[model samples]
Target: MGREELVRRVSEFAKESEETILNQVRKMGSSLDWSRYAYTLDEKRASAVSHAFVNMYEAGLIYRGHRIVNWDPKGQTTISDDEVVYEEENGKFYYFQYGPFVIGTARPETKFGDKYVVINPNDTRYKEYEHGQQIELEWINGPITATVIMDEASDPEIGSGVMTITPWHSVVDFELAEKHDLDKEQIIDKYGKLLPIAQEFEGMKITEAREKIVEKLNKKGLLVKVDEKYTHNVSKSERTGATVEPQIMEQWFVAVDKPFKIPHSEIKGVKSGDEVTLKQLMRTAVESRDIEMSQNGFRKTYFHWIDNLHDWCISRQIWFGHRIPVWYKGEDIYCGNDAPDGEGWEQDPDVLDTWFSSALWTFSTLGWPEKTKDMETFHPNAFMSPAYEILPLWVSRMILMSSFHLGQVPFKKVLIHGLVRDKSGRKFSKSLGNGIDPLDLVSEYGADAVRMGLLVGTAIGNDINFDESKVKGYKHFANKLWNITRFILENHHEGVPKTLPDKAIGYLDELKHIVAEITTEMEKYHLYLASEKLYHYIWHRVADQILEETKEVFASDEEDAKIAMSHTLNIILTTSLKLLHPFMPFVTETIWQELPQKDEDMLMIAKWPHTKD
Candidate 1:
């Protein structure tokens, strides 16, 4: 697709989604402005990315090198690890006979250019066969002796202790070739075509060449077997859904190893003594107990990841991102915020990775690089609530980036929520056809019930098995809240004001205690526990106990007693409404408007009920 069409579609889709979500938030009684907060990544974030890249490059961490990347042929660019997803595909595991050995492979099309074979020494089948042992392998062109070597990568548990080393194709083979002095014989071209080494089959596509190669092998009595029903995982481009070819390319990388501080330890790097590095900041934050992880178990995983973190690749061969600012003039490099001044110097065509842009989200969204008021006010953000999958890729990078740029961690706390699953326990996904649209639920049970249903039984770092019954139950709760409020308003025939009677005021201590409990739970990120507490107070305490007592007082028919009881009901209802407003804002606002609320009062913006001295 053209850039105009692609960008227009993406923008329109995002605009619609923003409208949907902002409408829901408004219906739930939130005060956030969608227009003020929304930002398109590439457009608004380019300057911030430029600043970060310039800083990183000057720090001596960024360098250009030839590396293997996840290449999308359709997109014709390099995609991030998060963008590529694996899909199970049905294909043949074609095995070709090389000498007395049967070499198993998923892509037999590349077999004509295969250099040599490797076998692990631990395999019992290959244990009898010593290293350097030659076998007479019948070739289509001629017969040749193929030697065997002990390769740790060749595991007998999965295969026959042998690996068909295709240096140009596999990432593992590429890495192995780099570490050793093994000569890399390039066979497959960049377009997945066999090189001149394929003899008459030169320049043939990998897919079509596979069939011809297999037929040729069968005629030469060298074909082994093919598992037609073999299922395997393959990476595909997220944007275009095209299969990715791991092609070798020169890219820029951030040296994340030595200078970066290792988590779960006190050893600072050599350059970290005087400098305010991300590692130093993170180490200090962890040591001082400044960072709060909602699920403590995830901290261990975070520590393990940071401890073993390798160099991060930050460049991509794509157009839809922030282009690198470096320029080259006869191999003399230039790094700056803008393109170079010379006529002969050409800018690098590759763009910065998406993660590099997202790393600046917290501050970049709030205006950075110019030291604006928004940046100062919201530089060190309070909370980050992303999914657990991007903890390493996004969350960790955000922390590192913020610490490096701003000299502080971006967020003080992280609330890692669970994924929502369907009733059968399958994750709600577009491909699975099991996704439950929130808009449909809002239309069916109302937005309040939908919000309550989501927040009711969820725990930190646990997936929620969504059921319609929970939503139905919350709908009943909404009904109960409406009915109870209407009951209180209905009983007050004397037009009771917002002011409370002395007897009603006596319940302030108990109400304060309840408010304190809820506030504490919310502060600790125990959302489910807070929801449960609200349910118990509203259902059991007010509806069952207090309402029953008020009915008894009304039966006695003392004018003063009646006033006290009515005022107490209103007091409890008002407090309860305020407490539940964050979760069930729509229902609470509807009921609050009917009561003796102040002029121009809004339930969502009203102060949270707090404990009194």
Candidate 2:
């Protein structure tokens, strides 16, 4: 399909999917402000993206550079390193005779681009070869000259203790080339076909070329030996499932290690005049306790990622995103929010990476780039709850962008939740046909039941093995709660007394302790513990014990005892509903509206119950 038509169709599909998601959220009774809803592709967000690009470019943090990237050949786009999925696969390791050294490589197809033979400097086997010594190597295409270089990155324990450097096809090779200023040759095209440099193997697929080249190398007496049981991790594109090709491409990148002056002094010890790199800013945000994670292990993960950070590739070869705000007219190239003030200036065809816009979500959604009330109030969001899979992709980029622009972390605390898998502990996928439709679950049991079932036994940062039996059980709990509310309303007297009766004082005190414990768990971001506590307290303690005991008081003739019993029931029901509201909002709110003594019009906005000292 044509690019424009494809973008149009994809956009329509995206809008429909977005509306379906919003409807499901509303059905689940989420208390989000619909009026302030913003889309990444909306005009305001587009403006924010463009503004950010221009600002970063002006600050020299964003630049066009030739660097190695994970290129998705099927998608015809450059994806970030985090988007690459590595899977262990069995392959052959071929050892080839190169002049005096025998080098090992798994990809003989990429050998056509070999620019250097790398060896460990400490390896005595290669001591005769001095650094920068030119050597003639036998090749399928004929004689090729390669320089010998010694570096510790080459493992002396590996096969042959030496390797050929294919700079255009490998990250380590590219880094070595950059360090030594060596030449790079591109042997693979964007279409994954061998380039003309491969001679007779030109235009052949990489797999086809590998077989053909290996056969020709064996005939030329250059192939040493092949280990058929070589197993290694191969990088593949998460979206297209194609093996990712490491290619050097000219793309826009955010220089994460480039130092820049802090624009704001809101972050502690990071004054406005202080200079820091994006990596430093992100590390400081967590190390200084400015941003706390729900799990301590996630903090370590965040720091490890930051310490090994690379310049971010921010451009994509896609049509349905914010087009890069760069224009070029002949020799004049401009990076700005708008096109150059002249004719014949064509804007860059590539769009910014999807995550580039998503990274600006916190501030851009609040009308950033222009001082606004929402930005001032919500720039440093108090809490962020996102799936753990995005800790490096979406979460880290958000931190990097926010620290650079706002000079503060995006959120004070991040609760990293895990994915919900099938009951068998396998990830739900289309191939497995194990994906559960949450809306169907909501229709079958109810939103509240499904919500509570999801939270009941799930721990922080742990994957949930969803079981429909749990939802069915929670559905029964909802019905029980409804029955308890009905019994309380039917048996209670006219007024809710200020104090608990002496007989029910013990229940009141127990409820107070449970409330305090639940509050503490919620404060620590332990939603699972909070949900379990609420379930047990409402079902066993209140329904089985207190409600059954109060029946005796209702049957008595003393009006004051019945009144005190009713007051105590009222406090228990209202407090329990408030505690459960976050997990089971719909049912709790519905039951709250039926109660005669509620302080707020909406149960969602009611004051959280607290324990008195």
Candidate 3:
């Protein structure tokens, strides 16, 4: 169904139930095509996700492994970087003795006793022990052992003069585990558990266990000393104010680039898929960042977000998304890993993050996980990624994903733009009461007028403020187009003249230049520029020129006026509709219908205009 019909149906259903996302989508004029809409929880999407995993599995890219993950326990899912929220936290640092050794920690009450004070092999202070051995750690009160790992971050002057390791709770611990090849010390598990070595603490509520263990340690005289006043930074759940527990859990994972390779020749011409070479991508990512910095358009210093990139935790411990396709037959785990398997083992309950599958959306939504015609035609647009709000997260991931999956960049160019901010240069937020309800805008000014206004002075990667004045200006432009076409229909004859009139061809050079300029802007993804150029031509140049000279023609000779007026009007209407199609689909389609040259045909499937590519 088309947008209007879908909206109508949704509106009808919305009235019959409690208001929900569907109601909101309808209210917002999302214009969804219900026939094509698949909920994240829908079977179609789940099957597609399963198919993707199976293909990757057969290729040996998907694997079950232990890795550090941004875990969201309340949501009970392993979240990706995009889903993680990092906020500043105030915490206490406790200094205590573990037997003979002194250790400082932020959580002396919980797993702090689980802390292992590691010393670097190269450090002259601990050079007495075997370079990699975990000595019996006899602290001031208790006995423990920990393998040594290298880190200059461990200051010799810190609390208890030692840094302890809890691989399951801290990223530093996991890194240390990797460095020393510590198996029992690894944070996550083969089956995914906190390990029975944690003693009674295993499977216990982390915070509650911390308190219980601390009390027992004090009773047993394992607690050496306590510093209640020291403050430090600690990890806290962003979604919830509770302290985050880095509990080891059994979760599915895909190893990053496990023996993954691309032959140099096979890598060529791959834009958005599996054939794109790592070398090519490193160069592109570097170039994109460098250009962004030098152009003074983007934030100068984005934190090194990818420097320590970890394996993406694709499983979400939630009911909302595509569940991981693998099924467990008592930990033997039957994965469709190679082919289409159906109807037996229990499917993994965890769902893929909305973005995990959406990273594959450009193709998945176009029938990927199974190739189709749209995929064949539009697989790698030699042009650009069309939207802007998705620049960092969705757009960037799609680019890399397309390269990794299809051996090509998804698109040749990335067209990025910022969100629509309000007049005070603040972003539109509900809390700020600054959001422009697009549907309200549509009702007040019409879709075409609003779209044109949104583009007027907008530039790639720049915020376009939503101002009433700009919308009014576009509304006036629409009115001008309407009035001009109405005048032509009323006064001019239907057919082109047998002989070309001198006046009609008089402005041909200028008209061709306008076309050339607009085409160039569009090809470069400078769409706002294209819109501006069109507006200037239509409102000021063409219309103004006609108003001035056409009056002279009408006064002197009626036939001369009719030929120039009819020819010019047709050109304006055709060009304007073409220019407006990507932004204002409905209004441009309506205008196209009112044109004398075309029959009734939907503009959505109309062949996109050609550029001098």
The alpha-carbon deviation from the true structure for residue 225 of candidate 1, after best TM-score superposition, in angstroms, is 4.4
lDDT tens digits, residue span 1-613, model 3: 7645754676567456534556545643345577776554355556667776776666666666667666655655565555544555555454555545556665643353353456544456655645455667544235656554556556655443356676666667767767666543433333223345556556655555555656666676656666556555555454554445554556665555354554322233333324433334533543554212232433222223334445556666665445577776555676673333555567676766667676666667667767789788877654433334344456555655665666555665444567778988886766788887676776888777887888767887777767888887788888887776676555555666555466666555566667678888887778889888888887787667755566555456567456766666566556656766676666667767766675337666665444321
lDDT of 2 by residue, 1-613 (tens): 8978989999999999999989888887788888999999999999999999999999999999899998999999999988999999999999889877788888999988786888889999878888988987677678888888889989989877888888998998899999999889899999999999988888999988787899999999999999999999999999899999999999999999998888786775577989898898888887887888748888888888888888999999988899999998888889988777979999899999899999999999988999999888887999998998899999999998898888878999898999999999999999899988789999999999999989988988899999999999999999999999999999879865667667688878988999999999998888999999999989998899888888888999988888888888888999999999999998999998898888898998888999982
**Model 3: how far residue 452 lies from native, Å:** 2.0
TM-score of every candidate: 0.82, 0.97, 0.70
lDDT on C-alpha atoms for all candidate structures: 0.74, 0.89, 0.59
**Each prediction's number of clashing residue pairs:** 1, 0, 34
Model 1 agreement with the true structure over 104-166: per-residue lDDT tens digits: 888776555455667877777767778667677677556766666667877777656577676
Which pairs clash inside model 2?
none
RMSD of each predicted structure: 4.7, 1.7, 7.5
Cα displacement (angstroms), candidate 1, residue 217, comes to 2.8
> Which scores better on TM-score, 2 or 3?
2
